[model samples]
Target: MDDASDKYRAPALEKGLDIIELLANHGEGLTQRELAKSLDRSPNEIYRMLSTLVRRGYVIRSASGDHYSLSLKMFSISQRHPPIGRVIEAALPRMRSLTRKAWQSCHMGMESNGDIVIVATAESPGNWGLALKTGTVVGLWNTGTGRVLAAFRTPEEIDDLIARHRRAVGEPEVVRAEFDGHLARIRTAGYEKMPSATAVGVTNLAFPVFNPSGQVVAVLSCPYLERVDDLVVPPIDEVVEIYRTLANELTALYGGTNPFEKDLTP
Candidate 1:
């Protein structure tokens, strides 16, 4: 009665740390048996811990097969908490300025399950604007923002997205080919700009936002209408430059250095 309680204080905390460390050291994911062996724990213990991690969004089961790997929920948590929250809050003022200067609505979106979902939005200064509200889900095959997100993902992720979407939506080969072609262009251009997927005569110009490790985490986009042949203001070059500058600013603010700075120029 005077010994056991003091010695075994928190098994749950220890189990969580063990699972994290095991996954970190393994690089490639481990099955329950392997994880158990590495941690010197029983398979049942490891399985329970893994199940919890998966439920909490800290781990994800591989789509290609049965395996577990770290998820970006940790990143999402960091973005939500302080320090990083301050940075994102500061970045919004600049996003608003860019939106006004370009006479276009702007959106910030992050990739989730292969789709891009808008998390923030700023309206154009003009009375008439092409606006996309926060939480708008962009299709991977059709939008500029979606293309940037798709381009930055790993090949396996791209394949998995395509496969899953195809199964769910029954997309034809022509649609797949079109998306592939857009992806190739995004890689070539180092950014994505195209006519709006959902609205007629509007265009979207987008650049990818990267983290310190050079992984694209989100995208910044401006939605605007194409000017008539007589108009000269808000040139495409100027808008692209603004997008690039915002991308760089966000990168630096978040402790990330730009890897595509040299490649971004026309």
Candidate 2:
């Protein structure tokens, strides 16, 4: 930033970092031309950097060789760092228990920058269940997990989050008023339950998990599916109750209080 810092700046390294940051915000990936135009650089300038990133496994070139996105390697590296890694370790077992009890797959997501990143996931005990992979970046406004995270935060924080948001691929656009009202409903209900925007016949259930300081640290979400002709599966209501309890236990594990005990006057 200063003259001395500017003098030591490595242009190539900066270009690579710029590319990574851009890709991080845009989960859908971008073409080289798009990346160059957005970064105010010529396509030729970034070609070598892109090639290097692809070689290092930090970026993935789409099958058509036209677009690039951040690879799991970057997310994997972040998971290896402290606190995040520990959080995933602490949540996976509980998530697994929830999946087993509810007979549905579940995932824990946290707000990263402006997107919801799936930090950990647990598959259902049954052979067939929907499960998102860890490290997947989902839309901030179009997902149950993302809404639960926003619903528990202050209005200012939510607005800031909205400002920084970049829509993921195929993420539907939500009007500001509708999004605000949706968050209000989530707050009043103390959780979120709605049909999946991206999948058919799946209802998403999400609850906020708080830290010791009463701030939401993450959200646990289950994509509920009714087994066809399987009468023994837990009912949707029962699954909701089980999932809520699991979220509470996770909050308690972080030394936080039950959000239901607090006034939720949205």
Candidate 3:
């Protein structure tokens, strides 16, 4: 190799990054021996690398001292980037607008670290709305927003994310497979309107928000509730149609294409 090539190479940094990416893809984690075997390095060589990664807060060691996994540090770091900021910036107003239109609470979330994290939320105008605060993280398999986000990704990406979500929720592999099928159905339907897995008497309505490449960058979801109000609440079916408009509007605001539009073409 040339001197210039040697100068640009940082072997140690590369090894550390390799470990991080592997753990991220795996989600559950790997043992030190497993990491070494996967990386084609000696355990002792990788031990120092793991130690450095753990100390720098990029990775965490289990209490057993035999396994390793990624910490949330990287996910936190990603939230500070411009793309995430722009997504949040472009989402809040739309979230509120959709909420006001339907008189239901809505939230926006994106997948991170094997979970769907609520980044912004707008409550229904009165005190009768369902409210989930910002920074709340929910499993990817059960939430409507989670399914919408999952439905838009490639199969490989879905597999990886579901594996992690399964580990997080401790659900059975059979359930995981069912969740995969559920996402496929959601893709065909172009939206998800179902009962909340965690809360009762509330229906979850979710739509996908896309980036310029038509990849789902975020999910806009609302928990639909009926109140004994002054007879002005939109029915659940109308709420679903309204969310469709909001999804298309937000997708266009970000210069994103709606994949379902192509499915609808004659």
Q: Which candidate number would show the highest lDDT if scored against the true structure?
A: 2
Which digits, one per residue and each the tens of the lDDT, describe model 3 over residues 1-266? 99999999999888988999788767678999999999999999899999999999999988888789999898687778776788778778877877888888888888776777887788988767787877676667778888898888898988788767643343223366778788878888787878888778989988888889879888888898987757688888888777777777788988888878545211
* Weakest lDDT window of 10 consecutive positions for candidate 1: 165-174
Clashing pairs in 1: none
Model 2, span 1-266: residue lDDT tens? 89999999999999999999999878899999999999999999889899999999999999999999999898778888775676678889888877878889999999878878899999999988999988788878888998988988888999898888778777888688989998989878898998998889999988888888888888989999988774588889998888888788888877888668455321
Clashing pairs in 2: none
**TM-score of each candidate?**
0.62, 0.80, 0.67
Judged by whole-model lDDT over C-alpha atoms, candidate 1 comes out at: 0.74
Residue range 210-251, candidate 1, lDDT tens digits:
777777767788876766656355877788888778987887
**Model 3, poorest ten-residue lDDT window?**
165-174
lDDT of each: 0.74, 0.87, 0.81
Those runs of model 2 whose alpha carbons end farther than 4 Å from true positions after fitting are 1-10, 21-71, 261-266
lDDT of 2 at 73: 94
Each prediction's total of clashing residue pairs, residues at least 3 apart in sequence or on different chains, is: 0, 0, 0
lDDT of 3: 0.81
Q: Which wins on TM-score, candidate 1 or candidate 2? A: 2
